[model samples]
Target: MNLSFTTKRLNVIEIDASSSMVEHHQLTIALPTILTPAVVANLPGYFQGIDSIAAAEKWLANMLNECRLLMLQSQQQEVVGLLFIYTEKHDAHIGYLLAEEYWGQGLAFELLQGFINLVGASSQWHKLIAGVDESNTPSIKLLKKLAFDERASKENGMLFFQLDLRKYPLEEGTI
Candidate 1:
C-alpha cells in the first residue's frame, strides 16, 4: 500500500480496487448533475459517461487497478474527490474532480499537495500535466496557484498546464 496522509479535514489514501470505499467515491462522482454547468463541463468524457452505479463502480475499479488513483475522504469518511496521476514517458498527467459542495474550500489544494508530496518522493517523474477546459476558470487558477505553467491549448480546446515537480520536492517527514 502507498502512504496515506491526514490533513486537518481530509484523509488522502491510495484507492484499492476491491475496497468498499468505492461506493462512497461513486456518490461523489454522481453529484455532477447538481453542480453548475460550467463545473460539469470541466469533467472528462469518461467521468461524464458514468450514468449508473455499476458503471461508477467499474470506473472506480479501473482507476484503481489500472490507473492507480488516490482518494480524498472527508472527516466523516465520505469520498470527496479523487486524484489521478498518469505516469507517462516523461510526465505524470494529473486529473481530479471534487464533490460539488466541496468546491472553493481549498480541499483540492490539500489533496494535490499531499499527492505531490507522496508521489514525488518515490517516482522518477519531474513534470506533472493537467488538461483543463478553458471554461473552467477555477481549476485553471488552482493549477496556477500551485505554480503550474500553462502550455498550448489542445485541438479540443482544453488548455494544458504543466508543473515541474523537481522545483517543489517535499522535505523528508513533511507529510
Candidate 2:
C-alpha cells in the first residue's frame, strides 16, 4: 500500500495569482498576474507572443482562472513570484518563472531549496521532480546543487529530474 503525507504550516501565506511582481534587490518575483503582461510583452525573447499590457492582462485573466499562487513576498509585503506545486499522478513538479533581472544571483536555489525542504518532510510524497529548458545552463547548474539528479533530457526541451524522498526531509530526520 502507498500513503502520502501532507504538512501543515501556519506561518505561510498564499497570495493571489493576479498580483504585481515583488522586488528584492536583484530579484524580481512575478505575481501570477505579472506573468501575463510580462509574458505578453514578451519583454525579452523568453516570451515571444505577448506584446501589449492588455494582452498580458487578458492572458493573466486566464491563468487566474485555474491556478492558485503561493509565494515568498518581498520586504514591503508584496507578492513577488509564484511558487507552488504542480502535481500529477505520483510525482510533484516544481517550477517558477522570475524576472530576468534576478537571474544568475543564486536566489533560485536559495528560495527553491528552502521551499522544498519546508514541505518535503511532512508529506507522503514518493518523489520530487523538476524540469528545465535545455538552453538554460544556469538553472541546470542550480538544480544540481540542490541534490536533484538528471533522469532524462531532450535536445532543446526541458530536462527531467528526480530526488529521493528520503534525501529531502523538511526537518532533517523526523516527521
Candidate 3:
C-alpha cells in the first residue's frame, strides 16, 4: 500500500524502495535507542542482532521487501517509529517501535489509531494480531485501550492479542 496519513501530531507514510535510503538512515539512529534488546525482547528474532548502520539498513531492506512498513514521522519530519504489518493467511500481524523519547505522550496511541483507520478502509484484512511481551505493561495497556482482546499466551513470555476488524467500528473516536 502506497499510502500516507496525517494525524494531529504525526505523518505516516508507507515507505517504498525509492525512499529506502532515508528510512535506512532513520533506522540506524532509531535501532540503538528504540530497538534495543530490552524493548524488543517480546518481538520476533528478526529484530535482534542489529548493532550497526549496515545491519540496520539490511534489516530495514528485508522488512521493506517482506512487509508493509510505514514510517511514523513527527511534525518536524523526524522518523520517530515504524508500524509493521505482515500477513499470514487471513490474519494481519501488527508490530511497531517508537523512539524512547517519544513514549508516554499518547503518540503511539494516535499512531495506532491511524493504522486502524487505514486498515479499516482496506478489504484485504479482517483481523489484527499482536504478540506483546508479557513484561511490557505499556504495550499491553495500549493494546487493551485499543480494544484488542487477549487471546493466548506463547513461549518467550509473549502474549497474543487479537482485534476482529469485522467487529470494529469505523467511526471516529470510537476507540
Candidate 4:
C-alpha cells in the first residue's frame, strides 16, 4: 500500500509511514516516546527477553532504515500494537500483542482498517502481505475479514496472506 494522507473515521489517528510503531495499536498511529525505561526494561518479557533493550533498540532503528513502522496507541498514549512496511517490496508486516486487559475488543480491526486505507492509496505497492502462524486464529480472522487472500500454505515458517492493493481496496466496504 502506498502511504498517503490520513482520514480518521473513529478515534484513530493516522500518520505517515515515516512514523514509528510506538503508537500503532490503540494510539493515533502516531510516533511518540511512550515506552518508558521501565516499560522498555520489562517489555523483553513480551519479546521473550532474549535480547537486551539496547540490542532491540538498535534492531528497531535499523529496521527503520529499510521499512516504515506504524503503531497503534491508546487515548492515554499507550502503544498497543505495531505495523511494519517494507517500502521497497510494498509489503506490510504486523506484530501486535494487546495487553491482556484489552482482549475481545475489535481494536485490531480498527487499527488495520485505517492502515489499509492509508496503505492502499500507494501506487508504490502492488500488494500488501501479512504472515501469521497457523495457530494465530485471531490474526487470521482479522486478515480474512479485511479480505486478504490466503496462500495455499505456510511460507518461511508462517502462513502468508496477501491483498492486491490495486484491486481489493480497503475502503471498498466491510467484509
Candidate 5:
C-alpha cells in the first residue's frame, strides 16, 4: 500500500528496509536531533544507550523490522521527526517525536491530524491508540484536542488514549 503523505508544510514518507540509502543516512543524522534528551525522557525504553552511529543504526534496523516507521520531512527537505505505528488486530498504536527546535510550533498537531485524515477512513484499523507519560501535559493536551479519549491509566504513570475512527472520522479541511 502507498504509505507516503504530505501536510501543508511537511512531507511524510514511509521508511522501510526498501527506503533509499540517502534517506536512511539522513534519518541517522536526524535521530540525534529528533530524539533529544528532553524528548526521550518522556518515552521510556526508546533510544536507550544510543550514543553512537553504530548503535543508532542497529536500533533503527530493529525498529524498521517491527514497526511501520514514517519519516517527517520539512518543506525545506529536512528530516525533522518520526512517527511509529504498530498494529494489533484492527487497532493501531502510534508514537511520535519531533526535533526539539520544532516543538513550540503546531507541527505535532498538524502531523497527527494529517495522519488521522490519511487513515481514519481506511478499513484496516478501527481505533488509534497512544500511550503518553502522565507528566507529558503537552502531548496529553494535543491528543485531547484531536478528540482522543482517555481509556486507562497504568501504574507506571502512563496514560492510555484511544480514538474510535468510526465515531470521529477526520477528513481533510474538516479539522
Candidate 6:
C-alpha cells in the first residue's frame, strides 16, 4: 500500500512503529483535540486514556499490528486526524476521526473523497465498508453522501455501510 498521499488540503501518511518520533509526538499532543469527549462517546472501545506519548505509542503499536493506520495532516503540517483501514478478503473497512476544531469544515468529505479516488483507482479492493455508531448522524450522512448503502445494524448499536467499488461511478475530473 502507498504510505503517503495528498488531497487538496491535506497530506495523508501511513504511521507505524517506525514512524518518526516527531510525528508520533505530534499525534500524541493532538489526541485530546482529535478524540474529544463527543468523539470518544461515538467511538466505543477504540481509545481510552491515551493522553501521553507512551500511551499513544503503545496504542499505535497495537493498532498498526492489525490495521493500516494513516495520519491526516493539514496544509500547515499539523496533525489533524487519523484514518485506519482493516482489510479482509477484497473489502477494506475504514474508520476516520478529525479534531473537534476541524469539524463542520468539509474536511471529512474531502478526506474520504480523496481516499475513495485513490483506492478506487489504484487498489484491487472490491469494496469499502464502514461501521458507525448509531448516534453518529453526521457520519451516517457523510457515508450516504458518498453513496455507501446502508447494511444491517449490529446488536452493538453500530450501523454498517458499504460501497462497492466496481459499481462506484467516478466523479467528474477525478480518477
State the lDDT of candidate 5 residue by residue for 1-175, as single tens digits.
6578999999999999789999999888777666778778867675656667777788899999898999999999999899999999999999998888998799999999889888887658899999998998899999998989999567588998998988656555556
Better of 1 and 5 by TM-score: 5
By the TM-score metric, which is better: model 1 or model 4?
A: 1
The TM-scores of all predictions, comma-separated, are: 0.78, 0.63, 0.86, 0.65, 0.93, 0.90
Q: Write down the lDDT of every candidate, Cα atoms only.
A: 0.71, 0.53, 0.81, 0.56, 0.86, 0.84
**Residue 145's C-alpha lDDT in candidate 2?**
74
Candidate number achieving the greatest lDDT relative to the actual structure: 5
Candidate 4 residue-wise lDDT, 1-175, digit = tens: 3333232322333334444465322243212233434223323333333244454454455545655655445666555545566644555554444544455688767767776676666556777777776777788899998888898877646788888778645444554
**C-alpha RMSD of candidate 2:** 7.4
For residue 170, give model 2's deviation from the true position in Å. Answer: 7.9
- Measured on C-alpha atoms, candidate 4 has an lDDT of 0.56
Ranking by TM-score: 5, 6, 3, 1, 4, 2
Q: List the residue pairs that clash in candidate 2.
A: 5-123, 5-124, 22-80, 29-80, 40-50, 40-51, 41-50, 121-170
For model 2 the local lDDT of residue 30 reads 35
Candidate 3 Cα misplacement greater than 4 A, ranges: 18-30, 171-173
Model 3 misses residue 164 by how many Å? 1.2
Model 5: what TM-score? 0.93
Clashing pairs in 5: none
Off by over 4 Å in 5: 168-174
Worst 10-residue stretch by lDDT in candidate 6? 166-175
Q: Candidate 1: what lDDT?
A: 0.71
lDDT-sorted candidate list, best first = 5, 6, 3, 1, 4, 2
lDDT of 3: 0.81
